[model samples]
Target: MLAAEKSKKTRHVLGISGGKDSAALAIYLKQQGRVPEMEYFFADTGVELPEVYSFVEKLESWLGQPIVRLGSGKDFYHHLEMHEGMLPQATRRWCTQEMKLKPLEKFIGDDEAITYIGIRADEFRDGYLSLKSNVKPCYPFITDGLVRRDIFDILRSTVGIPEYYEWRSRSGCFFCFFQRRDEWVGLSERHPELFQKAMEIEEGVNRRFSNLKKPYTWVRGMSLKELIADAEAIKEKSALRKAREKDPRSWQEILISDRQDDENQACLVCSL
Candidate 1:
């Protein structure tokens, strides 16, 4: 048992990533009366969507506990400057390392801790496993055989899924590079200010990295400005894709299945 290997004081930690899976894990553990002393935390990047913040607040209420908010003390722009204005991409994710993982590691310090991750049974991807011997990663969802549907059910019965799910599938910074083309359009429509900021950042990166083989952008082969210019087409394509996948399945189920196709293309620490 987990308790058997416990040190004199082993911290039980669960990270809330402002995504459905982590939020559902928190609720699931509470319902199971497991890890009553779990320390819930959110590693804020300071640039997440307003909807993500709102969802976290709602989730805290449902858990009936104050979710500790941790940060690296520096914002995204600071990290961007430190990286010579280069935007973080899938291959190079300094953003997740500096803004998310480092803060989490600092919070845990050298203390022995069990970090509960929310990667579901259906997901073939692995969570961020720290090399620090003091920190151990745990996956209750997989152990209990809970999948995507079970995550949705937990949220629906408790705090409900994040509002951003109506448009974006995952949660992270508003300027996250993992955003789909349709999600970028959704950002432009729902949070124009944030979208503008993202565009400005992309433009700044492109200016600094002008010597690169291609222009740096949030979306590959295209800039946010260019993406927004083709918003109608993107929307039409997204709608058609949804129509093609539409059937007797619930919207949540459809989204879950569609997201699985690109499961390997995400930052586990930020998305899960």
Candidate 2:
């Protein structure tokens, strides 16, 4: 209805994954008046960090627009059934397909939509998302030639980034298997219950796949139990490594660095 008959009015949609980049993008879009009526959404995996919710609330106030949350109503258990009890690994990421992408596709429906992505110019990964012909993907940050420093500056000038950055580098599901070894420790200490749930998922699934001895557990080599047991050593080493970076220090910066140091890339929408 917003666009004319021949024009095929495109729906302007921006997703806020409760991460700093997406939040900053929301602010940039509104402040720049790129699309005053841009629709914002957060695809909820239903197990995100509490700080994410609080951060989104702050962004909503700043953007003066509702960030509609599209949730997987059935949660992980429902999708797990569909995947036949096999836990999603990095190689076969069924979880992202079912929980993240499916919900988003449902929201757009048949509308001619412009999906704004927040892949910054400083980024090294390629998502290559969006297969829908009607849902054209656009990268505002990349097109604007805004890099990591620019994103940092925008977030700094605005809501100052989510507090979760103090602990975790990325934002997504609390039980996101992509979390670092030290982040698991942070999770256990900060949000014990959520950490417990994540560990249970690993333990239960590993037990089921014990016959094959699949090594695709949450972290690389160690189990959650082992990771927690070695938390002190890991945290101390992390502290030492972080002391070397000249930038302003935080657990988040350390985590981000750790993510880059390792070859593992976080999901675009989930981590922003």
Candidate 3:
């Protein structure tokens, strides 16, 4: 073919994980006039929080460019069934592998590209690293020594932090296994229908795999029903904890502050 001798052009891409840092990175790149042609994208899990979608829309409008939404042809439910009723957990994080990374890889294909990651300088973790030789991961925040405050600054100067942060700690699926008990309570209070859906998934898996060597729930050791049964007590403990804090931040601010470092770090692609 006539085009066989031509080299493929490189592309610039940024993945927005519906969290403050990634959103800030997109804004930071734009502000610096660094990569005007950068292709921004989000790997939609289909069951993402409504606020996540709303934040994505706001970010797209601010950038004046569409953040392409990629997904596997199948939904999370289908994947759960394929996994033989094994609910995704921290150890078995196939959800991220399939729902997030696979779609991104499919989008990039054989193209040589720099995929910008948003890991802050203060965080001692590397974000997602794709095995594809042609796709290189770049940590802009790390290179620039940008920390959490810098992320806040960038967001404040642009589309602002996601509204979901008001309740949940980080961004990802609504029923993300990484969520804390308090966040689950927040979800149940904020969006009962979504919470019920998550509960159903947990209950369904447990029932289908009754003989699973290691039975699992979205929250380990506690079923959603049990969590709900004790929601008031959890809330009371959260209130007491907040009351002891000397930070004078509002209740929501305090909760978010306490939540930021609440869990072991999640996959960057899902929560960065």
Candidate 4:
């Protein structure tokens, strides 16, 4: 097995999701000089946040190498039409498969690639975005026992957190369905253009799906239109909740402490 695995043409590669963990992982690998020819790539969905693009540019400068940007041949609209206008949710993440992971697999071909996954020791979930057996995942952070603190330190010590963190918590497409209700409002305030585009996508989905045998929307329980309809109330409620939490850090601290109970973890390809 060792000989066969060794004979399988190894490729050292890392994927940058434009998130802190991936960015930090790139820095960590460079500092350690583990894989000098490590191929860094970022799969672009075209619908990604501008902040993501800007952050990637900064990270590229720091690493002194251009991180390859892999994009879906077909735009999001094309894919949405192909999937009968279904917006990808947590359960149906075709977007990741088609837009992100597939491009990565194509880049690697049949070569056995040691895919350096950026998942920290603090996160205990598996990613479903990649299914290439030749592309094996290696968690250096876990091996080194690095945690969230280490990841934050890497960002602070390097290019700094992506500006989007001021509003949205995760990085991916601007209209990523994984977003919380508050994140949608954050979009409205921070990047109204992107939010409008997202609203259009939602509208398209609603129109396309309403004609189908079943109905679907980007968000569960409410369409973007409905969400926007009650945007004022939602914002007020969110503000009240924030006030109820007493303060920002205290609220986050409580949530973090509560979420460490093994069930609150997310397994998406990016947030790792």
Candidate 5:
């Protein structure tokens, strides 16, 4: 029997999550002249912060090549409906599965490919572990022993950090449930329209799934309505906590520091 037609050539891909480490990784690889044939992509959730799209465009300019956008072609609302009004949570990450990872896998197909991840050396957290044998992940930062400081330096030396980093620590949809209360407050202040959209999503889900044992909302333990009602109080508590920290860092630095303190690793596909 004729041997199965040879498969397509191996592919090199790097996903830019519009976060520091991932953005830095793309720059780092290009600077180091590694993976010269790398194909960059970003899975657009269609609900991401405006800054994210801008940052991706900046990175594309630096790379001198387009970072392909992959998705189900169905926006967040469509998938939310497909999921039966169940809001995506950290634990029940149907959003990530449907919107991010699946789109990635579909883009790569059955071709043998290397997916570069941006988990830094200092981080003990892991990224998406694909079950597809043909799709393997490589952590260049970890292999090169680069840490958080290295990532920052890489970005500062390039297009600089994404604007959203000024107030938010991670990158994902504007309505990501993983957001800390302070970050949510930042969203309300920086992008009131997007925050309002998120609130509307939560309110809609709550309405559609009223009879469910536990309704789905963006924030746990409270609705977006309650969260925004106490937004000023949340900001005050956050400021006091920052004052107590006694360390001088920009808002971005403080936000990153707080992230480490919480050790709340989010979806690698979305954050890293």
Candidate 6:
């Protein structure tokens, strides 16, 4: 009988979520002169924020190589139809699986690969771990004992933080259900067209799936129209939360803390 053939080479892959941590990880790896053969990729959801695309371009220039864009070739609407027009939620995050994870798995195929994740040492979350037996996860930040501050430092010295950080906290689709009410308001203010698109999706879903146990709006208990109607109050409450900060060391620290507060509830694959 012929002996079983084994994989000959291992692929080093890093996924840039267009967020600070993943961006920093790519820069960190480059600076450390490790993983020179690393393959960088971004799983584009096609509906990601404009800032995310711009930030990814900036990071690409810094990395001096193209970050391959992986997509299921089917946009969000196609997946919505596949899921029977039920909008994705925190618990039912079919979007992440269909749009993000499955595409990633398809890209890697059955190849033996080392996928690098950007979860910081301070974070207790286990980022997206593929169940594929041939694909293994490696957390460089955790192994190097790097924390949030270290990530910021890396970005500061490199491509700098993503511009979206000024408004939204995490990187994902413009209509991500994980976004806070204030972030939704930020979307309306910053990119009204995308915000309108999101609202339209919500309205359509609600109209189609009227019998769903819960309303099909992105925000819980309120439609996008209602959320925008109360945008001022949301902004005021966000401002008050900021004012309540006793003694932040710096504005960066405040931003970091704000992100950490929300990341716990965010999708590991999409947000991190």
C-alpha TM-score for every candidate: 0.92, 0.88, 0.93, 0.87, 0.93, 0.93
Once fitted onto the true fold, the runs of candidate 2 whose alpha carbons sit more than 4 angstroms away are: 1-8, 244-264
Number of colliding residue pairs in model 4? 0
lDDT of 4 by residue, 63-109 (tens): 99989998878898888778767788878888887888777778888
State the TM-score for model 4: 0.87
Error of 5 at 133 (Å): 0.7
Alpha carbon lDDT of each predicted model: 0.87, 0.78, 0.85, 0.78, 0.85, 0.88
What's the CA RMSD of model 5 in angstroms? Answer: 2.7
Error of 1 at 182 (Å): 1.1
lDDT of 6 at 67: 97
Off by over 4 Å in 4: 1-9, 128-130, 212-214, 248-267
Question: Model 2: which residue pairs collide?
Answer: none
Query: TM-score of the candidate numbered 3?
Result: 0.93
Residue 130 lDDT (model 6): 87
Show where candidate 1 strays beyond 4 Å: 1-8, 211-213, 246-250, 256-264
lDDT of 6 by residue, 1-272 (tens): 33334344788999998888889999999998899999999999999999999999999999999899999999899999999998999889999999999999998988899999998898888877889899999999999999888888888888887878877888989998888999999999999999999999999988887887778879889999999999999999998987796555665666766545466677766778
The total number of steric clashes, by the backbone 3 Å criterion, in model 6 comes to 0
- Candidate 3 residue 168 Cα shift, in angstroms, is 1.1
Overall local distance difference test of candidate 6: 0.88
Worst 10-residue lDDT window, candidate 5: 255-264
lDDT of 1 at 216: 82
lDDT of 4: 0.78
lDDT of 2 by residue, 209-271 (tens): 778655446777777888888999999988787677555756544443443523127667676
